[model samples]
Target: MQLLALGINHHTAPVALRERVAFPLEKIKPALATLRSIWTSGSPEAAILSTCNRTELYCAVEGKASHETALEWLSDFHGVDVSHLAPHVYALPQSDAVRHAFRVASGLDSMVLGETQILGQLKDAVRTASEAGALGTYLHQLFQRTFAVAKEVRGQTEIGAHSVSMAAAAVRLAERLFEDIARQKVLFIGAGEMIELCATHFAARRPAELVVANRSAERGTRLAERFGGRAIALSELPNRLHEFDIVVSCTASTLPIIGLGAVERALRARRRRPVFMVDLAVPRDIEPEVSALEDIYLYTVDDLGAVVREGNAARQAAVTQAEAIIENRVDHFMQWLDARNVVPVIRSLHTQADEIRRTELDRASKMLARGDDPQVVLAALSQALTNKFMHGPTHALNHARGETRDQLLSLVPTLLRQPER
Candidate 1:
C-alpha cells in the first residue's frame, strides 16, 4: 500500500474556493465510508482533517489507486467544479505525505504560524475516523507519530510564544479603533471555541457590556455566564447590534447572517457611531459588502491573516528549532514505513522454510516406523536437511560462468554466513 496526503489550504486557494470544498461536520464519517468504497478491492484506510483554513484527506491505499479518482470524489461530494479545484489541489506521496502530516500537526502549517487549535482539530478528525472504522494500521501509525512530533515541537521549542493568534489579533485591531476597550460594549456572535476565545480576550479588558448571540440560547447563556456577560437570541441582533461598539461574529451558517442592510439599519439606530466587526466564520457570518459603508470596520478570516502574522521575524528562532524537531521525526517515520517494504519477502521466506522442515520431519518419522536404527535415522535427517538448504545456492554457483560466477561466489557466503564462535 502507498501512503498519501491530498488537499488544499489557505496558501494554495482563496476563501471563495476553500469554502466550496469544505466537508460538513456530520458528513465526515459518511464521506470517509464513500471514499473507501471507490476502491475496487479492500477499501483503503482513510481519515479527513477539515478546518477553517484547510481540508486534507490522508489514506493508505493500494498502489493501483488513482489520485484523480480521489480528487474527483472530493469535488463531487462538495458540489464544486473539479476544474477549478484541480489547480489548487495537491497530492503528497510516501515520505512527502509523512512530512506534510508532521508539519501540519506541529502547527508549522497554520495560517497563524504557531497556533495550537489545529492540533486539537486534527485529534478530533482522527477520533471521528476511528469511530467510523475507517482507520487501519498504516494511517493509525502515521497519525500517532504526527501527534508525537507535535508534542516534541511544543516541548522543545517556544514556537507558540509571542505568536499572535486570530483571537488576539481581533483584540489588537479593536484596540487600534477604540481608545479604551474597557469603555466599549462588545458583542460576540456564536458560542463556539473561536467566539469563546475572542470573548475571553475582550472580557480581560472588562468591556462595559458583553453579550453572546447564538441560535441556542442555552449554549449561548452558558458561555456568557462564564465571562460575566449576557446572552441574547440570534434574532435579537438587529435591535441589539446598535448597542455594541465592537461586534465579533463566528457562526456555522453556510450563508451570510449579517447583511449590509441589517448593518445599515443598525448604524442608523446608533446615529452612525463607528462599529468594529470581525467575521471569523468561513462562509462569513457578516456580508463583505458591509465594509463599504462609512463608520463600519469589517474584517473576515482572511483579513486577520496579516494582523496575526506580526512579529513573524521574532518567531524565526522558534520556527527553526521546531523545524529541526519535525525533520528528525519525519526521518524516523519514513524509516518505519521503509521497513514495511520487505514484509512480504519476510513472510514468504518463513513459509518456504516451514514447508522444508515439515517434509524432512515426515521422512525421518517414516524411517523410524519401518524399524530403522534411531541414531542412523537422526544422522540421515540432519544431513538431508543441510543438503536441501544448500542445494539451490550450490546449483546456481556451479552453473554460473565468468562474471556471474564471480558475483555468485562473492554473495553466497554472505547470504549463508556462519556466525563466528
Candidate 2:
C-alpha cells in the first residue's frame, strides 16, 4: 500500500475555493464512507482534516493510486470539476506525505505559525475518521505518530511559547472594545473545539456570564459546563441574542445561523450597545451584512489574522528551531515506514525457513517410525535443514566468477545468519 495526502489550504487557495471543498463535521463520516466505497475497494483507510484554514485527505491505498488519482477522487467526491480543482490542490506521496502530515500537526504549515489548535483538530479528525470506520492501520499509525511528533516538538522546543494564537488574538480584540472584559457577557455558538477554545480564553477574563448555544443541547450543555455557564439551544438565540456583549460562533451549519435581521433586532434591544461578534465558521454562522451595522462589531477568522500578526516576529525567530525539530521527526517517521516496508520480505524469509524445518522434521519422523535410531534421525534432520536453508546462497557463491560473486559471498553469511546470531 502507498500513503497519500491531497488537499488545498489557505496558502494555495482562496477562502471561496476552500469552502467549496470543506467537509463540515456532520458530513465527514458519510463522506468518508462514500470515499471508501469509491476508492478503497472495501478496505481503504482515510482521514480528513477540514478546518477554516485547510481541507486535507490522508489515506492509504492498496493499488497504484498516484497523487493524481487522489486529486481526481477529491474532485469527484466534492462534485467539483477536476480541471477547476487541479490548479489549487496539492498532492504529496509517501515520504513527502509523511513530512507534510508532521509539519501540519506541528503547526509549521499553519497560516498562523505554531498555532496549537491544529494539533487538536487533527486528533479530532483522526478520531472521527476512526469512528466512521475509515481509518486503517497505516493512517492510524501515521496520525498517532504525527500527534506524538507534535507533542515532542511542543514539549522540547519553544515553538509555541512566544506564538500568538487565534484565541488569544480574539481576546485581544475584545479587550480593545471593552474597558474591562469582566463586565462583558460572552456567548459562544457551536460546542466544537474552536468554540471551546474561545470560551476558555474569554472565561479567563472573568466575563460576567458565559453562554453556549449549539444545535445539540447535549453538546451545548457539555461545553457550557466547562466554563460554568448555561446551555441554550440555537433556536433560542433569536430571543436571547441581546443578552450577550460578545458573541463568538463556529458551527458546521451551511446556512447562516445568526442572520442580519437577528443582529439588528439584538442591537435595537440592547439600546445600541456595541456588540463584539466573531464568526469563525467558514460558511459564516453570522451573515456578512451584520458587519455593516454601526452598533455591532463583527469579525471573521480572516479578520482575526490581522490581530494574530502581533507576535509574528517572535514566532518567525522560533521557526528555524521548529523546522529542525519537524524535519528530525519526519526522518524518524520515514525510518519507521522503511522498516514497515521490509516486514513482508522478513516474513517471507521466515516462512521459507519454517517450510524447510517442517519438511526435514517430517522426514526424520518417518525414519524413526521405520525403526531408525532417534538420535541419528534428529542429527540428520538438523544437518539437512541447515544445509537446505544455506544451499542456494552457498551454490551461488561457489559458482560465481566476478565482483558480484565476491560481494554476495561476503554478505550472504551475514544476511542468512543475522537472525540466528
Candidate 3:
C-alpha cells in the first residue's frame, strides 16, 4: 500500500483559487466517499482537510494511477480548471506524504507558522473520515501518528511562542480602523471556533459592547456569556446591523448572509459612519459587493495573511527545533511501515512448516500402528522433519553463486538459530 497527499494550500495558490477548491464542513464526508469510489483499485481510503488556507486530500492507495485519479477527482468535484491548477498543486507520494502530514500537524506548514488552529482542523478532518467509513488502516494509522507527533512537537519546542494568530491579527487591523478598541462596539457573526477565538481577543481589549449573532441560541449564548457578551438571533441582524462599529463574520453559510442591501440600509441609519469588518468565512458571510461601499473597511480571509506574517523571524528558531523532531519521528514511522512488507513471506514460511509437520506425523502414526518400536518411530520422525526443513536451504546454498550463495549462507543459519534461554 502507498500514501499520497494532493492539494493546494495558501503557499502555492492565491485565496481566489483556494476558496474555489474548499469543501464545506458538511460536504467533506460525502467527498471522501466519492474519492473511495473513484479509486477502486486500491480500495482507496481518503480524508479531506479544507480550511481558510488549504484544501488537501490525503489518500491511501496501491499504484501510480491513484495519484492522477485523486487530482482529477478534486478538479472535477470543485469544477476548477486543471490547467491553471496543475502548477499550483502539490502531489506528495510515500515518504513525502508522511513528512507533509507530520509538518502540518506540528503547525510548521501553516500560513501563520506554529498556529494550533490547523491541528484542530486536522482532527476534525480525521473524524469526518472515520464517520464516513472512508478512513481505513493506512490513513487511520497515519493521522493517529500525526496527532502524536503534533503533541510531541508542541511539548518539546517553543514553536507556538510569540505567534500572531489570525484572531489577534484581526483585532490588530480593527485597532487601525478605530481610534480605540475599547470604545467601539463589536459584533461577532457565528458561534464557531474561529468566531469564539476572535471574540476572546476583542473582549480582552474591553470593547464597549459585544454581541454574538447565530442561528443556534444555545450555542450562541454559551459563547457570549464567556466574555460578558449577549447573544442575538441571526435573523435580528438586519435591524441590529447599525448598532455596531466593528463586525467579524465567520459562518459556514454557502452564500453571503450580509448582503449589499443590508449593509446599505445599516449604513444609511448610521449616516455613513465608517465600520471595520472582517469576513473570515471561505464562501464568505458578507457579500463581496459590500466591499465597494464608501466609509467601510472590509477585509476577507486573504487580507489577514500579511498581518499574521509579522514577527515570523523570531519563530524561526522554534521552527528549526520542531522540524528536527518531525524528521526523526518520520524516520521511525517509515521504518515501521517498511517492516510490514515481509508479513506475507513470513506467513507463507509458517504455512510451509506446518504442512511438513502434519505430513511427518501422519507417517509416524502409521509406523507405530504397524508395530514399529516407539524409539525407532520417534527417531525417524525427528530425522525426517530436520532433513525436510534443511533440504530447501541446503539446495539453495549449493546451487547459488557469488552474492546469491553468500546471502543464503548468512540467512539460513539466522533463520534456524536456537532461541536464548
Candidate 4:
C-alpha cells in the first residue's frame, strides 16, 4: 500500500479557498468514510484534520490513484468545481506525505510557528476517524509516531519557549485596553479548542468572572466548570451582552453570531464602558461593523497575526536544527516502509522453503517405514531439500551477465547463507 497526503493550508491557499474546502467537525466522520470508499474500493484507512488554518486528508491505499481523483472528490463533496480548487490544492506521496505530517504536528507548518494546538487538533481528528471505522493499523501507527515526534521536539528544543502564540498575543492585545485582566469579566463564545485555549490563558489571570456561551448549553457548562465560570445559552447573549468587559468568540457558524445591534446594545448597557473583543472564528463570529463603534476594541484572526509575528526572528535560528531532525526521521520512516513493502516476497520465500522441507521429510519417512537405513534416508532428505531451495537463485546467478551478473554474484552468497546468531 502507498501512503498519501492531499490537502491545502494557509501557505498554499488564501482564506477564501480554505473556507470553501473546510470540513465542519460534525461532517468529518461520514466524509472520511466516503473518502475511504472512493479511494480504497472497500477497505481503506483515512483521517482528516480541519482547522481555521488548514484542511488535510491522510490515507493509505492499495494502488496509485491520480492526485486529481482526490481533488475531484473534495470538490464534489464541497459542491465546488475542480478547476476552482486546482490552484490551491497540494498532493504529497509517500516520503513527502510523511514529512508534511511531521512538520504539521511539530507546528512548523502553523501560521504561528511552535503553536501547540495543532497537535491536539490532529489527535482529535485521529480519534474521530477511528470512531468512524476509517482508521486502520497503518494510519494509527503513523499518527502515534507523529505525536511522539512532536512531543520530543517540543521537550528538547526552545521552539515553543521563544515563539509567540496566538492565545498569548490575544492576552497582550486585551491588556492594551484593560489595565488589569483580574478586574475584567471575560466571556468566551463557542466551546471549541481555540476558545478553550483562550479561556485557559484568560482564566490564569483570575478574571473577576468567566462566562461560556454556546449553542449547546451542556458543552458550554462543562467547559465553564473548568475555570469556575457559568454557562449561558447563545440566545441569552443579546440580553446579557453588555455585562462582560472582554469577549472572545470562535464558532464554526457560517455567518456572524454577534452583530452590530448586539454590540450597540451591550455598549449602551455598559454606559459606553470599553470592551475588548477577539473573534477567532473563520466566518467571523463578530460582525466587522462592530469594530467601528467607539469604546469597542475588536480584533480578528488577522489582527492577531501582527502580535504573533513579533518574536519570529528568534525562532528562525532553531529552524535549521529542527529541519535536520525532521529529515532524519523521515528517512528512517521511509526505510521502515520499504522493508514493509518487501514483506510479502520474504513470506513467499519462506513458504516455498517449508514446502520443500515437508516434501523431502515425507519421502524420508516412507523410506524409514520400508526398513531402509535411517541414516541414509535422513542424509538424502537434507541434500534434496537444500538443492530444491537453492536451485532457482543459484541457476539465475550463474547465468546472469554484465553488471547484473556482478550484482547477483554479490547478493547470492548472502541470500544463501543461514541467518546469523
Q: What CA root-mean-square deviation does each model show from the true structure?
A: 2.8, 4.7, 2.9, 3.9
**lDDT per residue (tens digit) for residues 1-421 in model 1:** 7888899998899877887777778889999999988777755899999888998999888766577888999999998889989999999988889989988988898988888999999999999999999998889999999999999999989988888889989999999999999999999999999999999889999999999999999999999999999999999888778898999998878888898888999999999999999998876688888999999999887888888777577888999999888888889888888787679789998898889989999999999999999999999999998998888889998899999999999997689888899
- Residue lDDT tens for model 2, 1-421: 6788989987788766777798888889988887676574536788899999899988888765477777877888778999999899888988789989998998888867888889989999999998998887788888888988888877777778677777888999999999999999999999887888888889899999999998899989998997899999888999999999999989888878999899889989999999999988876788888999998889888788877777777766567777788788778878887797789889999999889888888899899999999899988988898889779887888899899888997886678566645
Please give the TM-score that candidate 2 achieves against the real structure. 0.76
Assess candidate 3 and give its TM-score to the true structure. 0.88
Off by over 4 Å in 4: 41-43, 171-187, 199-212, 218-232, 238-247, 259-277, 283-299, 366-376
Q: Which residue segments of model 1 deviate by more than 4 Å?
A: 371-384, 387-414, 418-421
What order do you get sorting by TM-score, best first? 1, 3, 4, 2
Q: Give each model's whole-structure lDDT.
A: 0.89, 0.86, 0.89, 0.87
Give the runs in model 2 whose Cα sits over 4 Å from its true position. Answer: 40-42, 174-188, 199-233, 236-247, 260-276, 288-298, 353-421
Total clashes for model 3: 0
Q: How many residue pairs clash in each candidate?
A: 0, 0, 0, 0
Candidate 3 residue 122 C-alpha distance from true site, Å? 2.1
Error of 3 at 152 (Å): 1.3
Q: What shift in Å separates residue 110 of candidate 2 from its native position after superposition?
A: 2.8
Q: Please give, for residues 102-132, the per-residue lDDT of candidate 4 as tens digits.
A: 8899888887888888899999999999999
TM-score of 4: 0.82
